[model samples]
Target: MEPKNQTSVSEFLLLGLTDDPAQQPLVFSLFLTMYLVTVLGNLFIVLAVSSDSHLHTPMYFFLCNLSLNDICLSTCTVPKMLVNIQTQDQSITYTGCISQVFSVLVFAYLENYLLAVMGYDRYVAICHPLKYTVIMKPHFCILLALVSLLLSTVVALMHSLMLLRLSFCTHLEIPHFFCELAQVLELACSDTLLDNVLVYVAMFILGGVPLSGIIFSYVHIVFSVLRMTSSKGIYKAFSTCGSHLSVVSLFYGTGMGVYISSAVTDSPRTTAVASVMYSVVPPMLNPFIYSLRNRDMKGAVRRLITAITSFL
Candidate 1:
């Protein structure tokens, strides 16, 4: 049932990451820099992967998709936050908030699944090297990407549709920079038992399943590496997955940290502050992690830079 007393509410006030007037400019500048770095870094990864023929394999193909996901994920939240901070307007219209939620959900879930797919790609490349080409063929890679996008779309749509059914009350101040699903749900006026249940189920299916897959893939990869006769082969195999493993640790760790922080703390502001670690940090760092650790990526980036400079 809709709340009759608060039926006229049209906008939700986002409290944002901070409320200190003195800190606003600093925050804006800091986030703007992070956002730019995140965008340019991921863009470079995408461009490098696309331009370099040597990176046309399944691993780099998935890396390109992951970079694309990182771009969208950061874009969905950072731009809005930056706009709000720069304008000093925390009010987000209902439609805008819903759109933000949907976009963020889609990209976030897609990234999660894409990381798992990358793990599986590595698994195939390492465990069954002979069949890697057959298993991760171009068509198959496309199919995996399609499946990730489709699943994420469906899940985001489900959350968005469910959100549409709920009526918000007069108290619509969200204590976060963006319309995160959990924060938005907390502001709902109606009974959210079903929404809560759905979120849990979806989290288990989306988050748990993918994390399990990544772990399983890594476990097999480790076993395979252990079986290698040459020490150099083990080192090479580990080096190849090092960047991915770091990302997975950072991504899942920050997410779990946010969840745990929210659960253990009673402060919405604290949770919001912690959320930045997951939302902003991972995307900003992923490019550096991949590029710095990878010789092939370094060469591709150099080539990309050289070509761009020559063209200019």
Candidate 2:
């Protein structure tokens, strides 16, 4: 091995979401708008959860954590992406590259686990209504959230640390918009067995664990719902879970689409476009989804709007 090869790579090229000069400004403006929406929308969720005493429950606590994670996740990638587009430079310093990848991994995985925990929360509330509070105590909810954070951090650390060690002596061009782990791994000059293993491990931890938990919770929920004697009761019970189910579907569906698209397609531009749905669409839409569908959220929004108008 050459000394030059052994030395760490200090920078990387992002390649961005596209190569078309015409599309650069369009993508830049679009993401700038979406990034602002993601931040403001999640901030609203956090505020709604915090200000509304009626919402200070285990479920809302998890939701608050979720909104926080969504904010972090979007902030991790979007600003740099916008910069790449506007500056006409697709370069990222090695430190910045690693930081973005780690932050995305951390918060993305947090959403997965938080959503799963929310499913379980709904299960307890609906299936075992008698003991919902006993089971979903404040301490338990906080602990679950903290565990999600810890788990995500550990998995991200594993991948980032391993990727950091492998010097990228050449092939600085990253395939996708951001410093995605897969794209970064593609840029490595050394053998990537370690990187590959770390990525696979991260996917398993992030995807498999939460998915399994959600499945089990839904199974129990279905059983409970089926046993209901009244149609209205069933409808009402299912309604309680409607918002959560919507988020889960959108989040996982778009996420899986990105993964499958990357696997089946070779075009970096295509992958970046597909990845946008997962990264940008859900958080941007969540506030609307919940606000339109949830009465409490609607009321909170009304109050917030009224307060602002009065101030004006």
Where model 1 places Cα greater than 4 Å from the true spot, the runs are 1-5
State the RMSD for candidate 2. Answer: 2.1
Model 2 agreement with the true structure over 1-312: per-residue lDDT tens digits = 442463566788888777779988788888888888888888888887787888898877887888888888888888888877777788899999999888988888888999999999998998899999899988889899989899989988888888878777666888678888888877677789978976787678667988988989989999999999999989877777888889999999999999899899888879988988898788888777777777777887778777768989
Q: lDDT for every model? A: 0.91, 0.84
- The ten-residue window of minimal lDDT in model 2 covers 1-10
Q: State each model's C-alpha RMSD to the native.
A: 1.9, 2.1
Candidate 1 colliding pairs:
none
Which candidate should be chosen as best, given TM-score against the real structure?
Answer: 1
Against the hidden reference, what TM-scores do the models get?
A: 0.97, 0.95
Kindly report which residue stretches of model 2 are placed more than 4 angstroms away from their true locations once superposed. Answer: 1-6
Report the lDDT tens digits of candidate 1 across residue range 145-200.
99999999999999998998887787788999999999999888788888899899
Q: In terms of lDDT, which candidate is strongest? A: 1
lDDT for 167 (candidate 2): 72
Per-model tally of clashing residue pairs: 0, 0
Model 1's C-alpha root-mean-square deviation from the true structure amounts to 1.9
